[model samples]
Target: MIRKKLNLFLVSLWSVWMLQSCGNPPLVDSTDLVIYGGTSAAITAAVQAKKMGKSVIIVSPDKHLGGLTSGGLGWSDTGKKEVIGGLSREFYQRVYDKYQQENAWKWEAKSDFGNKGQGTPALDGEFKTMWIFEPHVAEEVYEEWIAELGIEVLRDEWLDRETGVTVENGKITAIRTLSGKEFKGKMFMDATYEGDLMAAAGVSYHVGREANSVYSEEWNGVQTGVYHHRHHFQVLDQPIDPYWIPGDPSSGLLPRISAEHPGIKGEGDDKVQAYCFRMCMSNHPDNRIPFPRPANYDSTQYELLVRIFDAGWDEWFDKFDLIPNRKTDTNNHGPFSSDNIGMNYDYPEASYERRKEIIQEHRDYQSGLLYFVQNDPRIPEKTQIAFKEWGLAKDEFVDNDHWPHQIYVREARRMIGTYVMTENELLQKWPTPQSVGMGSYTIDSHNIQRYVDENGHVQNEGDIGVPLPGPYEIAYGSLIPKKEECSNLVVPVAVSASHIAFGSIRMEPVFMILGQSATTAAMMALDQGIAVQDLSYTSLRERLLADGQVLTMEDRIIAK
Candidate 1:
């Protein structure tokens, strides 16, 4: 009997060990707030929660911090800098402070790096803020900020989208990650660009652009003929035929050109905007890593690009926006640049495995494009020669082979919260209530699809860039889900907004601003023992103003 009992006990112990080995860890202590994502918004929200004396934990799916900010998008898209206040402005101030040191300029001198930006100077000494910086510098700032605040971050902890969230009476009580680590919190903030937590919590959200009629907005849906930016094929000297053999329909379409009919101008479609990695390239020989040819690279994939070049489009380096130390935040520029048009339509709702596949495909495409630009014989000799001077920055995203760790999601699952911000609200045709933050960037959307036009010429569609008259207030209701859905959760990055409105609001600085505001509201709600949705906006506004958040155009004028 004793021997049998011993055998059973040993078997039970082995089972327990196996479970632990498979990543089923114990439940963590509940905190006041559980902030998910490793983006700039997550960092800002964590910092704000800490400042408010609330116990917070950042459960990050990413190994690195500061999503796109630390990811290659060093050149910021701040439309009006005066409106970027609170932790958002402070982040830029920290970057400026970092650059002040002589050692900060390693590859180049600060004097040699001009202060040019979108409109204002990149390094604003008077404002004590730097709008542009290197990827490593941004990551360093986030890491130091987190360390300074002693914020606990559980890295590589992905939330289990299925059977993970424990909701009771329409409030998320705790969330379990795939590793079986359970995190309980009184309040939760989904700061991810993808809105993973918000979706998993059963919150109502939108994936693609709504029709113009849905929101009564002029720039919300499939914009087939509208060409706002220089990203359309119309910029080419002449029309490029979509067929593999110039004008022969039987020869089949060239790679990357869709065979489907381009949708109606104002109609809605279930398609999202293109996504790309904002490549950080370096001209400096010492800090440059030559672009590696992706294993699955097919030179044929860029046949359309060759045609674009053939059509006399040569502005390849137009968006190699320079940053510190001779590096650049190279973004998608012309018709056939880095933005992988129409490839990421399903990424917003894709599973982790599928998302990885999509991300890898994008990596391969972008990497191959770089390799093709420098080495392909079809590329213009002069263009190839010029492109060869630049390579991936060796110092950034070291773990990810000098490539950016985060893909610019641009737009994903925007939650359908208490108030849905539309173009009407952004253009001041409709009033935005309970302002928590502000954004002034132009309403921008990258190409959603590339198809053959009526003339049988290849063309890109859905790249809209409508300029804003001025900075507009962001509604506080845009951050919270409908009270009946999930009361404890607040979304900062994927706040509720129409597709066009999101274009203006998706900037990193605005995300940080919203993040701080969301956290402040969360803390206030916790103090009052109320659901986040029930938090009084009047009190929230007072706290936000006190915390230096610019929520209105009036506030911007006063600050200026």
Candidate 2:
């Protein structure tokens, strides 16, 4: 009996030691910080915590890091490079440093890349600028950030959002993932574009577009007269069938287009910005994957596309935006782009199975569209040949059958926090407090939904692209959920923006910038032993300046 007791005691002690070395199991009752949603912001937060001498781990459903940064937006959309300081700026600088070597471009010398830098500060052969890139290169930068931080990342571990979130005494005590593991943390950060974790935490949020009257803003919801890209009337000259019941008796609905009438020109509605996958494709013969016909291919859904081709819309072949490594950060274009506008209405609040189905539908739509454009007999010969010249990127997304892992959810679940950034704020009307960073991209929203125009023809709405007068401030308050709702959580990417305001903040570089600022907030809260909302803004602002974040473009510059 004595020997048996000794063995049991030894086993228990060994287990305890192992737990400390690796990490306490889920709900193991410990963790300095737990970040929800594995995004560019989450990674930045983990880095900041680790730097401040705290143990941190990321719980995410995605297997990859750097949400959209590494997703497919390689070419960053940096409106003003000088204003992009802090972690957001660091991401691009790192890309520049990586390519400074002769070995960076491989067979091509600096001469072959060209001189006109795409939207960003990148130099073809010229000097670096801000904006745009290939997906793989961005992924490499994110992977490097992970390596340098030594973060404990648990990928594909979903938040049991419904019952998995456990809060005690006004604090989130633990979170359970789909893998049946629980995570305990003193503080949490919601870095996802969808604001999923914040919603689960009972943080107040808003979905869909708001009325121009409510926020007293110009651009919101089904905007009519604005046409930036050729996505509207340039080609959709006639009426398309309304998806209602056939022949009479209220056929009542179309397949993808919504039945409800889209609201007035400047008024707001429940419609959300469209979503799609940011495809990563390559032209390199060795790495290129051939585009194949989708299993659920449907020809009728693309009748408009067929008509576009017939109308000499032969620009389809040249639509792809190429990135480094011969890969493309493929995006939506023309009248029928990748966005399945009305198709994803239920995604933000849908079950995992339902979400998966939506994702598959988008995949089929995009893939089948590509296949149809290249293979369908209805397409003009030049357009087909041009498309055939390109193929599915063979070398990219090697893990998931070369398909991009993420779907571009432009906007969803915006937190109705203490401070809601309205369109007036983006236009520099409100005096934001303790500003942490600045953004310059115009207020841009994609097609909110398909609707009939005043001219009685079918069309898409909410594609507003208005430029900002100048660089403006993004407040620290925007990052925190209301103090009354949840004290220890911070939301960076899905900061308190009115739906229209988010159009500008939705860029990758801007997201990275916010990620760094949020981490700074998290660290300050930890060091002071207070809720994230209660952290002293004076100190927070100072620290942000020291860390190189551009708070304001005040004639005299300030740094954190």
Candidate 3:
């Protein structure tokens, strides 16, 4: 009996130990550089660090890497192709190489694709680059880079902001994820759209538009009457009613229409610009997947859309821009489309679970939108037939039922670093110093609020699209935090910029360029045993120029 009791105790102790071991997360290997977020910038940073002979790992919150680039934004929002160089240009060149193969055009012939793009030729032989491509192709390029460089990426690991981050003497020594794994590194980079790691490290950031006066800017705040693009209320010929019942004051406002008052123009607010999923769809019969009506679909939610049709504005197929292989990078065009405005005001700071709910809501909204445009009897027959020809691409996003995994987070938490980029710098009115990269895109902001105007008509506010004079240099200081906050951290995607300035700087190619620059700076800082902010600009500029980064428009020879 004594022997049996002893054996039972031993078994119990072993079981308890096994359980404890399973519950504890494995210790992540310490490295020279740790990058958070699985964005394209993250991939670029990892590759750059690896090339610089620094041990690096990408701690990604997403299972899939390449945030928007792989998430159905195939139609690149390129401004000036000449300004894109370095690894950013290399990525596009790889896409060109992929397309050069005949098998890449599975749904359509390569010759039928024709040459089409924004600022440059779709196929540039001199540069050997293609600006437009499919989502899967972009993802494949990122994966190829990872495979070639042997860069390690930890997928599906989220940072535990509450207690997971361990800061020592104003520097992040280690960061723990919600999965219990801890990554220790000498230098860190936050390349997420939400700026989660930057916030977790106690770095200061702003969530919404700052007042124009705050930055001595022109296009920063609640722009109500000042309209620059066709995305505003100007698109409507006749005033559309906001209530469920037309011209009835007793009825409540329609879904997705806010009843709150729009603030004064040029004033600051905590409201962020709208976000939507840049859907990848195809017209090819074999590659098309019929739009499945979401289980949570409610036709009543689209009451405003029906009212818009009655108003006689039928430009539905305007933004269904064709990419390659009969697929299109469909985006929001007019007043009522894919943009789920006024509903995502809380998403920037929401919890993970709340963010999931918001994402699901957006997915449902867009899915139902596709279905409604194709099947609804109220829609014009001509428009319905046009929309019916397009469906979700079967070969794209197969892992998640053909829908894009990421939503276009147009604007999110922006860091307030050592230097805040403002409109004066973007417009070239003020000389930008410590140049790192260049941004040439226009200052484009989606609608922030859709509310009832003073004249009792529904109007959208905060859609500002102003063209820039030329490409302006992005300062390296904007990527680093105040020395007292964090000495060894760099933020590329969520750089320090005012809302107007970020609108111009927040393009995907720009993010990739900045990511490479940030990695170079991090490697230099590590070698010199100094903080990122204290790194010498002369050495950094020389290295960047040697690496083929276009720091000024004068360096670019635009083919007339």
Measured with C-alpha atoms, the lDDT of residue 128 in candidate 3 is 88
lDDT of 3 at 300: 84
lDDT at residue 338 of model 2 (Cα atoms): 85
Q: Write the per-residue lDDT of candidate 1 for residues 1-560, one digit (tens) a residue.
A: 99999999999999988988997774457799999899999999999999999899999999999999999988999999989999999999999999999999999988999888877799987788899999999999999999999999999999999988899999999999998888999999999999999999999999998999999999988888899999998897788888988889999998888899878888888899999999999999999988898888899999998988887888999999999999999999999999999899999999999999999999999999999999999889999999999999988888989999999999999999999999888888878999999999998999999999998888999999988878898999999999999988999999999898999999999999999999999999999989888888889999999999988877772324
Q: Name the better of 1 and 3 by lDDT.
A: 1
Off by over 4 Å in 2: 1-29, 106-110, 115-118, 124-131, 234-255, 317-319, 555-560
Tell me the number of clashing residue pairs for each predicted model.
0, 30, 0
Better of 2 and 3 by TM-score: 3
Compared with the true structure, the alpha-carbon lDDT of candidate 2 equals 0.75
Query: What local lDDT score does residue 48 receive in model 3, on the 0 to 100 scale?
Result: 88
Off by over 4 Å in 3: 1-29, 557-560
Sort all candidates by TM-score, best to worst: 1, 3, 2
TM-score of 2: 0.90
lDDT for position 274 in model 2: 79
